[model samples]
Target: MLTLKYFFEPNVTINYPFEKGPLSPRFRGEHALRRYPTGEERCIACKLCEAICPAQAITIEAEEREDGSRRTTRYDIDMTKCIYCGFCQEACPVDAIVEGPNFEFSTETHEELLYDKEKLLENGDRWESEIAENLRSESLYR
Candidate 1:
């Protein structure tokens, strides 16, 4: 008579919240509005992103400066409506907008997630280094 003996397996699962998995280079994540080196917003208020967005999550209102330079007076991106398609980043001619490697965007209210120009710019400033590093690291593989 043959007897089957099986040993209990140990828990091999990693602690996810503490030990997070690495993200791929192509991972499209939270959105940000970039700025120029001179501290001016990179967006020309062209509305290309608004038009190109399949979700229509982006809203842009433009106005001319005293020098006749166009800038976005009101730029809003509804995070609830965004699909993270990255089309907005691709549509931006001046690299004003980019998808950062941050997927931790969570809020208690929808209004908190609806990013305005100031909020987006702050995000860009905060995550600029990470975004640049990720881009550079990915460029090496390409």
Candidate 2:
């Protein structure tokens, strides 16, 4: 039988906790906010990403810093409303917002899916190296 033919073959099932399938170079998993090597945030608060989101999941408010430079005061993303269209990353002029290689952001409550500025910045710090590698591998604005 067709079902019996596979019985003699080796198991191909992956142990998910210990192994994971490779994501494509173009894969957009989760959002992150990047900072410069000097620890300064890269977003100019231009609101380009906010204007470009079809799902209206991204919200940002910018204010002038002490140096009279613009910076975001509040940046929030509702992950539940996101369409994963990758537009936010594309619309960023300074490459401040990016979709990192993280897909394991599941939470027990919906409230946890609402990401604030602090969470986004933390995500950037956590995944910066991986994000850079993904960008370089994809030849995307590296």
Candidate 3:
């Protein structure tokens, strides 16, 4: 009876990497750092992201820039240690940090999982439109 039931069951698995799968609107995946419309970095070096990270995956160092603006000299996220609780983005006052839609960031080595400021910024640039749209939709409920 068990073998007969299995023989008639339809396959539920889809071809991934080609067919893809659906993701929720509020799905938290890779992280990114946003920028203002004026091309200035949105992060004020508030240390909120670092402080609020439950996994202690975030590390930040700030310095006064030449223009006297407080900027992060070093902002790194140890992705290996991240728990993806979405606390970092939620604690950000300026919405500088956001978790984007892309989740395909599989790395061959553990060292590659350490995300630096530049890499996060690059991710922001790459997924800005999607991130903004997600934020816009998310704000409607609040």
Candidate 4:
């Protein structure tokens, strides 16, 4: 029978926790806020990301810093509301906001899905290299 044919063959399904699957170069997963090499945050509080979010998941508040630099006082992204359309990343002129290759971010509560500025920044720091590489590879065609 057709069902019995598989009994003699090896398992096609991968053990998820033990074996990882492949991902595409343009996979959009977790959101992150990047910084410049000089230790300055790349986001200039332009609010472009907030404006372009179709789902209205992004919220930003800006203020002038002591050194006369414009910066965001509050930047929050509601992950639950995000449609993962990559609009926020495209709207960012400075490449400050990016969706990193991190799909493992799962929380028990809905409140934890609401990412604050600090959480985004931390994600940025943690996945900077991967984010940069993904961006670089993606920019080659354009």
Candidate 5:
């Protein structure tokens, strides 16, 4: 019976690390900092995300600009504490923050994984193509 079952069934094991499986459109992987049309930071320091974060992993400091626009003076996401629930992304009105497709976020140090504004922006820039492709591949955003 076992031999018969094996003969009839297909291989269910995935060859991960070499042949990675596809992720769902709503998969919350990593966080990214988005940019504006003019290439400026997209976060408007609204504090909605901060308020909505159940993990309390997001830290945001704001300041008034010359144009009277409230901008984030300091923004940090403690990846160690983050549960990747996508609440921050959902709370963002301007879509400044997003949970990206890249999941290879291993780090040697705990502090290294705690992504700051610069690191988040770098991740956004590096994974922009992949993020765009993922978004385009799914109908969720449409």
Candidate 6:
């Protein structure tokens, strides 16, 4: 009787490929490096994210540029090692490093999962709108 009632009810299964379910405001997904509206990279090379990552997935190397501004020369994240604890995002004071709403980053090889600065910047550019919206939504509840 109960089985028949549930079977006759409306279908609730998600067609994951064709349609995506609504993500929460605090949903942390793929990691990305954000840039300012002026097109400059937001990371000041503070290395705070690196320090906070419990999984030790994040690594950053900083250097002082000729113009006397601090910048990161090497920024890498090992996605395989990451626990997605969102600590790195919270540790970033400049909001340079953020976990955006993109969890479909499956790779064919393990080496491909080691994200470099350029790749992260590309992800930032690609998902800036969604990332910003997610951040805005997150702030509303705070």
TM-score versus the correct structure, for each prediction:
0.84, 0.89, 0.87, 0.89, 0.87, 0.93
lDDT of 1: 0.87
Assess the local accuracy of residue 18 in candidate 6 as a C-alpha lDDT between 0 and 100: 94
Residue 16: error of model 2 in Å? 1.9
lDDT of each residue in 1-142, candidate 1, tens digit only: 1223323555467797898888886689888888876888899999999999999999999999999999999999999999999889878888788899889988898799889999999989988888777767876654
Q: Per-residue lDDT tens digits of candidate 3, residues 48-138? A: 9899898999999999988888999899999999999999999999999989999999999998999999999999999998998899989
Best by TM-score: 6
Worst 10 residues of 1 by lDDT: 1-10
List, residue by residue over 1-142, the lDDT tens digit for candidate 4. Answer: 9889989999889999789888777899999999999878999999999999999999999999899989998999999999999999988999999999999988999999999999999999999999988888899754
Q: Supply the global lDDT for candidate 2.
A: 0.92
User: What digit string (tens of lDDT, one per residue) describes model 6 on residues 1-142?
Assistant: 9999999898798898898899886899999999999999999999999999999999899999999999999999999999999999888888899999998999899999999999999999999999998888787664
User: Model 2, range 1-142, lDDT digits (tens) per residue?
Assistant: 9889999998899899799988887789889999999999999999999999999999999999899889999999999999999999988999899999899999999999999999999999999999987878877553
Candidate 5 minimal-lDDT segment of 10 residues = 133-142
Q: In candidate 3, how many Å is residue 14 off?
A: 2.6
lDDT of 2 at 45: 99
Query: On a 0 to 100 scale, what is the lDDT of residue 141 in model 5?
Result: 63
Worst 10 residues of 2 by lDDT: 133-142
| Clash tally, candidates in order | 0, 0, 0, 0, 0, 0
The C-alpha stretches of model 1 lying farther than 4 A from their native spots are 1-13, 137-142
Residue-pair clashes, model 6: 0
* Deviation from native of the Cα of residue 27 in model 2, angstroms: 1.5
Write model 5 residue lDDT over 92-128, tens digit each, in one string: 8887888898788788998898889898888788777
lDDT of 5 at 89: 84
